[model samples]
Target: MHLLVCGGTGCRASASDSITESLKERLQEHNLQDEVQVVMTGCFGFCEKGPIVKVLPDNTFYTEVSPEDTREIVEEHLVKGRQVDRLLYQAPEGGRVKDSKHMDFYKKQIRIALRNCGFIDPESIDEYIARDGYFALGTALNEMEPRQVIDQIKESGLRGRGGGGFPAGLKWEFASKNEADQKYVVCNADEGDPGAFMDRSILEGDPHAVLEAMAICGYATGADKGLIYIRAEYPLAIKRLKIAIEQAREYGMLGESIFDSPFNFDIQLRYGAGAFVCGEETALIHSMEGERGEPTFKPPFPAESGYLGKPTNVNNVETYANVPVIINKGADWFSQIGTEKSTGTKVFALAGKVNNVGLIEVPMGTTLREVIFEIGGGIKGGKKFKAVQTGGPSGGCLTEEHLDTPIDFDNLLAVGSMMGSGGMIVLDEDDCMVSVAKFFLEFTVEESCGKCAPCRVGNKRMYELLERITQGKAEKKDLQRLNNMCHVIADTSLCGLGQTAPSPVLSTMKNFWNEYVAHVEDQRCPAGSCKDLMRYEIIPENCVGCTACARKCPVGAITGERKQVHEIDQDKCIKCGACLEACKFDAVTIK
Candidate 1:
């Protein structure tokens, strides 16, 4: 039996390394070192229950494993062939799940970009080779012409997974057609979405896959040099990528004349300062060229002139992760997976309000309901489902009406949201719509490159308007003004950062008009999330003459005699909810 422990950043932080060590020591003590192999692999995507330990042969998936559980795992599972009942993954429905494939969290997930992530030791090139890692690059370099390779990718119907669902094959063809002395292929690993780690996780888990795909892209685009512009914040991913690149070079896979062929391609790493705008191809190219990460107008698009003014093709990490797979697996095989328009799979960092918060990949046509209910294990704490925010800060909030909508590029766009690097944040009824809009606007406002007036001034203005609405200080007519300003920002913004900055406000206003109206017309926050819009009241009958709230009131907001019903002075109340928590009787309530 082989023991695979999650070595990804999340699991590692949770002491998965110590778990691996303990298991190894126990294995040696039991004289099963040679018979059983303990391998530390990448993330398993079920992050909520990590650090994960999956026993192969039977695929007995264990979760929330600590260093102390290592000996138990070895003695019970490895030696006696009995699974550790406590370590085994228990489903939300009160049953132990031995295999991950049977769990709701992974049942609907079709992992393509993340295929070898949790299964293989990413730093080992031989392990990567065993999984047919560089075969696609070798095939393209040896047998297939550049145009033919491009044609195959086009036929696969793969779209870029890095926010914009642009056709990947078409983008490559654009750079391929452009003739220049030197050309470049770029992997945009500078993922900056607030809760999105799709790109970073892919790099940390499957670095070799990205390298192979980059080499293939270099061959197809007639680019001799490849650069990965990853954020400096991802030290683990950066280290693993550096190791993977060095291994590829040593194996004669990355350098010139690979497979005894004339094709010469090598990859290098460029670090970014984690600017959100740099996710844009032009801005990324500019950052690589030692310029500010701000975006310039795209008349001379990155494909035409980029990175020192040469033909450069830029695709994000998840997009590149799919390239080798599509090349190895036939175009028809890949094209058949999803809908006609949007093909293949999308990797999502599923977070916020969901029970099974983790990294998940699903086919393009999978419904939001399937993702939320089945794959995500439904909303947390049995809370009423409110909305889901897709496409990161730039994407819009979607409601229950959109849950059944097929999750493709066009469908999400039609619903006032785009699939922006696959950050699906599920919202519950407790989440205030107006507050949610303000939150995303705040993020966009802060992350804006400030190069264009629309993103800089307009987004700040939009954020201010959202703030007014959330704080219950806005007029009803302010909604119309907010709507108008959002359109202006979308129409006039120089890049996507400004263009989609207003999406959250517009979408929330469209879906949760009543909530916004409550905050405005009634001067109340419906979800009680906005503290300024909430009034703390003491229930007259339920108070039971409790003095606890009065004593605990930090600002002397509550006033009453001892053993007497308490009353709150709204003027003194800071809306901290401390009185509510301090109340012994169920006396305090929010109005």
Candidate 2:
């Protein structure tokens, strides 16, 4: 029997390490340590109830487990074969889910890229092998030709998950067609999207799977050398990747001939400084060549001239992770799972305001409503769902109207959003759309490489306009100006990063125009998020005249005598809401 504990970063932060130690200690005390094996695996993806401990054979999933409960888990579940009642996942509606297979969170998810995660110990290469890990690489090298492998991928309809949605097979075919003495396969692991940890989690959980897929890519593209351009900030992912590479070499799977074939392949790591612009292919290529990470115009795509001026093929970590599974399962099987245009499953870092905050993988045709409401366990705190931001900073905000829309690349694009590296941030009723637009614009302004004037200047201008609107200082004409600038920037920008920077502003304007109008015309923030547009006042009827609000006012904005109604000086009020928090009688209110 194996006890798998969630070793992913989120669970680890929530004291999973202590839970593991406590479990081991308790198991040892009962002299059942030898009989039972406790393993620390990567993310289980159901992170809302994390520090997860799953018992094998029966597959009893224990959630939100603390160190104190470890003894009961061992004694009752491990020894007596009785499952812990309270630790089992309880649904939001009602009823306890003893089995993960029966849980709503895991029901719709089809784990292809995340197959090995939360199932195996990532450090152990043997564990990966036992799960048919290297079988795809071996099959490609031993039986299939380079062209045949490419054809299989083409038939599978696998598109890049990293923003562009370019066909993976076509990219390899393009690289294979280009004749060069040395070719390269580059894995873009420098994931820069805010609220996104999809690539990092994948690398941490299934490092060997990436290595195997890279090797397959090398054979298909006629590239002997491979490089993974990952961020320096991902220390745990880097460590695991290094270990996986070293182990693969030791097992004769990565270096020289693989599966006793004449093909030669090896992989190395290149560290990135976490530049958001580096998510762009050309900018990433420049960074790898020891130059400033700025995007260069592409007529000569990376397939023709890339990585020290050689024929190179670049694919993101998620894209490559799917290759092995597609190969092993065959194109027909994988293609049948998703929509006609989009094949296979997509992995998303499901975060922000959602009830179930974690990682999730669903078929390409899965509706946003299902992902946000059912799979994500609905909006956090039962708040009304306002909008959802897919595709990170570059993507647009999708409203309730787009709830039933299928989550494919083209579907998302049609709705003013794109599937940008699969970062889905859910926004609720309390979130201000104007403030949201301003937030994303701020990110783009900071992350813009500044090579293109449209992104560097136009984005800054857009941000300023959004700021002005949020502060209740903008004229109605400024709204039209903002719209025109967004179109110009999208039309003129050199790369995808710059082109999509105005998506948030445009999307919010389209969906929540009333909110923007309220900010400007009425000089009010509808969500009460913008401090400049907020006015704190004392409700005379509700006031008990306790002098609490008056004393707690930071700027002495509230003046009153004991047992008398308090009045707020709007000019003196900083809109800090300090008085509201201090008033036990609920006298202070926002105007």
Candidate 3:
């Protein structure tokens, strides 16, 4: 019997390591250590009920497993052969879900890229091998030629999971056509989206999968060396990747000749300073080469010249994670899973107002309604769903009307959004659309490389326009100016960063035009999110003259005698909501 514990970064932060040790101690006390092996695996994708524990053979899954609960898990579940009802995941409607297969969160998910995650102990190469880890590399080296491998990838129709949904096989073919004595394969692990962790979780849980895929890519593109450009912010992923690399080299999977074949491929690591612009290929290559992480014109694409001027092929971590699976299952089988154009599952970091916040993978053509409602368990606190921002800052905001829209490269683009790195942030009715646009613009403005004037100057001007509208200080003409500037920056920007920088503004203006007009013409914020547009008033009838509001006012904005009606000095009020919290009689209200 195996006791699988979630060791992903999220669980670790919640003290899953202590839980694992506690479980081991309990097993040792019962002298059942040998009988029941305790293994720490990667993320289970259900982060909402994390620090999870699953008992194999029976497939009994436990949610929010704390260190104190390990004793009960071992005693009742393991020793007595009974299940722990309290720890099991309770369904939204009623009964408890005993395992992941039955949970609504896992029902729609088809985890191809995240196959090994939550199943194997990541630190142990032996565990990885037992699960057919390096078998794809062996098959590629022994049976298939380089061209044949590339052809199979093309047949599978796997597109890049990074931001651009470029064909993976076509990229390899381009790199292969280039005659460079030294060629390279680069895995872009610099995931800088606001709510995205798809790449980080894959690296932390299944680091070897990426290494093996890079080696396979090296063979397909005639690249002898591979480099992984990952951010230094991801310490856990970095540690596991280093461990995986060392294990692969020691096991003869990465060094000189592999599987007794003459293909010599090895991988090295390059650290990024968490620059969002480096998510682009040319900027990433420039950063790897120790230059200012800025992008140049793309006539000489990374396929033709990259990383010290060699033929280099770049794909994100999630994109590479899908490679071995495509090799194992035939291209026909893989291609049959999703749509004809996008033939594979995509991993997404589902965050924001959703109840079941976590990492999710679903086949292409799945509707946004299904992912947001069924898989995500609807909005938190029963709030009305406002919008969902896909593709991070580069993508657009989708509304209720677009809920039934099929999620794919073409479909999302048709609706004014992109499938960028799979960051899905769900918003509720309480969220202000104009504020949301400004928030993303703030991030883009801060992270801009300043290489192009359109991104540098144009984005700042656009951000200022959003700021004025949100502050209830803009006229109706500013709305048209903001709209016109969005197209200008998008058309004239040097790289993807500048080109897509205006997406949030354009999307919100298109979808929530009334909200923007409210801020401008009425000088009011419908969502009450913008502080400058809100004013706190003391309701005369509701005030009991208890002086609680007066005592709690930080800036002395409210004043009243013990038994008289209280009055609010609007000039002194900061709109901090402190008076509202302090008033027990509900005297304060926002206008």
TM-score of 3: 0.84
Instruction: Give a tens-digit lDDT track for model 3, residues 1-591.
Output: 999998865567789999999999999999999999999996665555778899998888899889999999989999999899999999889899887778766656898999989888889899989989999999999999999999999999999999899999999999999998999999999999999999999999989999999999999999989999999999999999999999999999998988889999999999999999999999999999999999999979999999899999999999899999999998999999888888899999999998778998999989898888767766776678999999999999999999999899999999999999999999999999999999999999999999899999999999998999988889999999999999999999999999999998899999999999999999999998999999988888888899888888889878788889999887898888988898888777898
lDDT of 2 by residue, 1-591 (tens): 999998866577789999989899999999998999999996676665787999897888899999999999999998888899999999888889888777877767899999988899999999999999899999999899999999999999999988899999999999999999999999999999999988999999999989998899999999999999999999999999999999999999988878999999999999999999998888999999999999999969999999999999999999999999989999999999889999999999898887678898999989998888767766766578899999988999999999999999999999999999999999998899999999999999999989889999999999999999988999999999999999999999999888999999999999999999999899998888899998888889999899988888888888989999999998888888889899898878887
Of models 1 and 3, which has the larger TM-score?
A: 3
* Winner by lDDT between candidate 3 and candidate 1: 3
Badly placed stretches (over 4 Å) of model 1 are 1-107
| Model 1 C-alpha lDDT per residue in residues 200-233, reported as the tens digit of each score | 8889989999999998999899999999999999
TM-score of each: 0.83, 0.84, 0.84
User: How much is 39 displaced in model 2, in angstroms?
Assistant: 24
Best first by TM-score, ranked? 3, 2, 1
- Candidate 2 ranges with C-alpha deviation above 4 Å: 1-107
